[model samples]
Target: MHGVRIETDRLILRPTAADDFDAWAECMADPEVNRFLGGPQPRAVAWRNFMTMAGCWSLQGFGMFSVIERSTGRWVGRLGPWHPEGWPGDEIGWGLMRDTWGKGYASEGAAATMDWAFDTLGWTQVIHSINPENHASIGVARKLGSTLLGPGKLPAPFEDDVVDLWGQTREQWFARRRR
Candidate 1:
């Protein structure tokens, strides 16, 4: 398994731990955070989701990293790669507490994760699928230099709400890094 720890100017992206339950629950329960997630799930459901993420490292080799504020060493949210139930390929996903929004933490953490995915995992391309109406997440994709690939379907079991797929290839990432 990849025991990767990514660091940004103000955040440390590390593996999720048991102690993250409260923060994770808070973020997951926030209406703003779940606005595009089909509404806030209950605390119990959020805890289950956290466990699933913690287990993904063993099951998938790479999984979502909990975003922690370096200065406070507190969980801010989660950011990294994930493979949802029917996703065509590995996807990069991110979510931060509403209180932490608009501070560039999401972009910073995501950019760091993207660098790790390309340089360490050698992933040639990464996909980010977001609800069509989630403009905030769409902006994050653009900030990472990803291009909208138009409407796309995530495999079975997903709702009919079409998601916008954004992708960034290794070549594009390298070019951006060189800039």
Candidate 2:
């Protein structure tokens, strides 16, 4: 398999697998976790979404990673670079299982994903689409050194929803790292 794996000091960001279903379903099924991510979805819906992500890797060469805690060896969430057709931009996004909140995993995974996107994937820029009410994600974006770029909207199913595009260029990211 040509799956990609990125290791951080505390977590591993890798491609999704069939074995990841239960944990993925668990997280996706949580109302709190999905509050700003389009609301809680049924297991069947979660299965289709999970399969879509897996297919994205096979077709796009890059997509959301199944975030794993190094210590627990359990799935914590999914965070990484994504650029599906009709997306506002190349984005590095995240959604953790409610239990995984407040541990800084989002920032850790996002930083790694930004590094991989800018350096490995040769992407020059990355954005994060944050709902105005999603203060947590806004904080994470700030911690990652991304500033609010402007307003943006997601494609169908979420076309009516609004988002603040937060991001930095590859150069900006490197400069922040040098600090």
Tell me, by TM-score, which candidate is best. Answer: 2
lDDT of each: 0.86, 0.93
Model 2, 1-179: lDDT tens per residue? 23578999999999998899999999999999999888999999999999999988898888899999999999999999888789999999999999889999999999998999898889999999999899999999999999999999889978988799999999999999999
Any idea what lDDT model 2 has? Answer: 0.93
- Which candidate comes out best when scored by lDDT? 2
TM-score of each: 0.94, 0.98
Q: Tell me the deviation in Å of residue 18 in model 1.
A: 0.5
Q: Mark the 10 consecutive residues where model 1 has the least summed lDDT.
A: 152-161
Name the regions of candidate 2 deviating beyond 4 angstroms.
Answer: none
Runs of candidate 1 exceeding 4 Å displacement: none
